[model samples]
Target: MKTVADIILHNGNIQTQDGFHPMARAVAVSGKRILSVGSDRDILGLASSHTQVIDLDNRLVLPGFIDTHFHFYEWALNYDSIDFSRVGSFKEMENAVSNKALALGEGNWVLGQGFNESDWPENKIPDRYDLDRIAPNNPVCIWRCDLHLSVANSLGLKLAKIGFETPDPEDGVIAKDTSGRPTGVLKELASNLIRNVLPKPSRAAVLENMQKAVGDAHKFGLTSIHDIRLMGGLDGADALKAWQQLHRENRLHIRCHVALPGEMTDQAIDLGLCTGFGDDLLKIGYLKFFSDGGMGARTGWMTKKYLDAEFGMPLTPVADIERAVLKADQVGLSVMVHAVGDRANKEIIAMFQRIESHDRTRCIIPHRIEHVQMILPEDLEKLSTLKNIAVSCQPNNLSLDISMIDSCAGPRGKYAYALKNILKTGVPLMLSSDAPVADPNPLAGIYSAVTRKRMNKTPEKGWYVEQALSVEEAVKGYTITPAVASGTGDCLGSISKGKIADIIVLDQDIFKIDPDGIADTKVDITLFDGRIVHER
Candidate 1:
């Protein structure tokens, strides 16, 4: 019996990402998998009268993008939150919060996020008094773009029961005024105090919002994501439950690999959960751990002091991380640690080396280092030696952090966001948006990676042009490399026979355009599971 394709896309420029057959003119999709990829004639021959054949008109088609580090649950819930991503000054931020407060009418919580003081003219961190002045009657809390810090109003702080008398929690900080009064600025775990006290949305509301978020993701050509867990482990269980609920309801259009919090290693082991535990639609991913905070917050556990002469702090001690990694490894669960500073990266690399030395027998999935945001050259060399290790970097963050890193790290900024250098070391480099921290659009990420510049195209020559990746390399970072990280390389990365049919058609050829314009490129069509999920 001849196998007939359910759908056929012909006369298209398809980037298969398979070395042997790197490019194809057409593709045939049967059910949820690719049935054939070849010249237009070959694929068109597989189409029967019932097949839905579409002429691509020479449009660019590529594998669907994969965001290896995304806070899906968090982003979905904050869909309606006030966006300060474009706010330019302290007054602008104040006005935004004030407006939200007035609209919600007193006593309701006014929550906002994605404010970066570094981008503001004032160049000063907002304090509780700043928020209190604008939203006095209503409790207000706004997060820094990096999410490593947050500022709340006095009412918000009082509601969380945090005051000068309250001591900082482990791995967190409560900034204080000169008079020793609470300043409403919380760092790391301290922000969780307010988060825990905030009223959560109902499960039904979350699911509805998540479905909308999935739709938005499809617009950006994202067909898969590694739904990352936040620090403090507050959202891990809920996040996993949400994804599972979406799956059970038959509403999960995008593939997801939900990570388990490192703190829950024992529970996962007891439940017989390991990496890649579920089906293709969803699976258990890495055990997530944090080695330090973000660079923007000056809490990234650095080897040296910042320009302000302050050394960053570690959220989790190196020794503690090593112990957890070893324990998780013994149970066949890979770990992904968030390391932002040079010291943090160095420590994590050494820890992974130690693990490899002790246990070379287990068939463990490749462990990962998230946000290798900053690292020394020697550390990069050391990282390359670990055969079972991969890296997930956020180019979108590089666009957000260029100015902040230049100001904080100064000369050492040369080593920050070295995408090309990291690639040279022979380690698998997966690109991601780290969404909610930065924009989640893969094109925006690709632009930043290739241009090493902000969306505005500043720094005419580009930031450390030496570190920029080529277009093909950046695309690989979002495609082939992420597939390897998620342990789905054989089935999800490329447009090959027998692989999952997750692909997208672009309105413009990103590879052929000027790198600066890549950020503005749009996805004209998106196909997930061999079905057209989105059409522009």
Candidate 2:
């Protein structure tokens, strides 16, 4: 008698994202592994009366998404915080803050995030005075969308102790008016002062919040992610503990590859940890390093000055990065460094070249660069020819940064987000949303990559249309490429025999839809570990 399969998904347009079995009409799952993938007739032969069979009704099925770069742990906790993303005008922002403050009442901290004042019609960053007028009794701290800058109300500033004469810390800026009074805008490491003053969430709270995020991720077809750190490299230990507890309790449904801040590289080394240290469900990923601030905050450390601003600044000196890379790589710790500007990218590339020359086999996983958002064409050869280096780009950011890049990068914008060129260079370019920074929707990423246009589809011809990727290539960014980057290529990322049974069925065939329609596509069913986790 043939063995009965646990579940059989048949009559579907399954795009396996595997080179061997690129397409299939049905797939059989036994336990947590794929039993077989083939035509409906061949797969049905393995199913018995006890098996749960599903007919996809011609829907599109593919491997579950893996976000190469995500701060979803932190984004999950921000549910209680105010969300000011896409606020059109200053009046709207104030109104939103006023409502939240009223809800929280007096003396309570009113926390918020995702305020991009640059996109507002007024084109002005709100000062402490603007927040004080509306929420005088409550302490308010709202972070910019980029997470590199924040604005605090007077009460919040007082709590953080910024009453002028406080020297700007190295690698940080405390924005102030001419009279030397802090305007309540804190940039880079300066935001840490206010963060230190704010009440911290307990570990239990973090785990609870992460459970909610897991449930939410299922609905969006995300089965795995690389949990990255927040700015300034704080709380890596605490965050790891939270994830460890969640995994031990068997409450963690998503596969997590957690990256530790480079500051903790020594601790990781002492603990005998290296890349891919844990089991399939949880693993130690990379030693994450931030080389520069974000472009959204005009602190991306560009090669040339912005249209009106100073040459952007480097958040971490090259010496610190080089030392960490050398030490970590010697102990088999792969590095995932964030580089968003041409200068940062160029500098990091040089550092990687030096390391590659010295020791090529130390790290188990070769170094990767996160958000290769900008690179001069002249320097493309470094990233492309280097077989060991990988690149992770977030097209979702392109949707939010089209205007910002144009304004800030000016004519040099040609070199910004040159994803297609990166792909041609033989570099493994994985797609990620960056979550809280941009919506962590893989479909939205595909839309942006295929269109090179913002949400509104401005610039009728598309922004640098030449760089747009085909549907197949864009889809690969979220699937096969990321799977290879995370070192799960053999077991995940496709519907193939012996691979993990992680799949999602979409309401629309993304390849058949118009470029604009990609963002509107929805998931109808999601299966993780051979079980139906989401259905709509």
Candidate 3:
């Protein structure tokens, strides 16, 4: 008995992602899954004469890209906020802020993101006085490109309830002016003071934005995404409920793997919610823990304090993070810790080792350390032994962190975003955009991974020339590796029999082109469940 195929995509250079079939000419689909992948004759044999045949006419096709770490709400939030990401000068930034404030009516907080002081002509972070002169009564909060640092206006500080008497929290910074008054520059955990006061988006807004994000993702050749932080807590249970509501109403499109935050991890576990608790539409990813702050904010925990800084590395003491990982593991939740600096990576490796010894790899939890930036050579070697422990690294960091890297790490800045070093360690590497932090463009990320060039197109041989990965290796990070890390490898990553038919067609042969040209390649078509989601 033969299974009847519903759709057949013929006459294309199919990059299987699977080692066995590396390249093929066609693929046949039945309903929502791949029925067969081979020559046109082989596929046509499985397809009925009435089946729809999509003529590729000699194009390049590959598995849909998967992002292992991204923030859905943060990306969607930009749809309604002032975007200052392109400001090249303080005057430009000032004008944009002032104009936006004047038009925003009264009493509303004028929020914006993606400002990098290093790129500004004056080399100065805009202060409260600059904002006060523009907006006056309206409060303002402008986030640094990393999304880890922010500068607030005096009114914004007051709204966040900060005062001269306020003490900096353990993991955050309150940058004050020379006169001892709050200048409104906040770092790491301190920025949350204002974030906590901000209004939560209504459920209607979440559904709308998530849909928009999914549509945008498909246009970029993305089929699966792992959302790192869900703003409304409890595994972002409220957000998931809304998504469920949308899915039930037949409105949802993309596949989401939610990374439950530490704030809601205990409660979720207590409620017996474990990893992969949902179906193909939505599922639990990992138990996310912040072992350290971000690189751009200069807050990533380090073995040694950042050079010349008064405060040493800010970290979630090893004991605290370890306890959390251990507990989550006991209840079948995989741990995904953000470890950027050497000390942070070392501590997280220790936590994984402890869990590996105790749990003996039960249920194959894809425990991973996010960022894994600036890791010690020893820790990388240590990570190689744990089969289930993976690394989700943002290759685009090279393009975005050049200035922050130079400012914070000096010459070693070259070693900061080492994707190749991570891959060489034998641990599976996953790729992501951390979108809103970086655009969710895998081609941009892959280009950065291979060339290591910053936005200005500087650095001919890349930051650390020896650490640049080949284009083939970079594709695996965006495809099968992330699928494996997210626990959907068996069903979603490859274009093979029994795998869900999620595919993307490219207009150019990225593999055959020069490393720089990879960024210029465009997505021609995107499919989910064998149905066209986006076509260009």
Top lDDT model:
1
Better of 1 and 3 by lDDT: 1
Whole-model lDDT values for every prediction: 0.91, 0.86, 0.80
Q: Estimate the TM-score of every prediction.
A: 0.98, 0.98, 0.94
Model 2: lDDT of residue 89: 77
Model 1's TM-score against the true structure = 0.98
| Over 4 Å off, model 1 | 361-363
Q: Which of candidates 1 and 2 is the stronger one according to TM-score?
A: 1
Model 3 pairs in collision: none
- Tens-place lDDT digits, model 1, residues 295-366: 888899889999974778887888998888877787788889999999999999998898889855353578
Model 1: number of clashes?
A: 0
lDDT by residue for model 2 over 457-511, one digit each (tens)? Answer: 7677789888899999988898888788768898888888888888999999999
Q: After superposition, how far is residue 522 of candidate 3 from its true place, in Å?
A: 1.1
lDDT of 3 by residue, 415-521 (tens): 57778778887888998887877768899899988888875566776777688889989999999888877778898888988789899999888888888888878
Q: Residue 445 in model 1: shift from native, Å?
A: 0.3
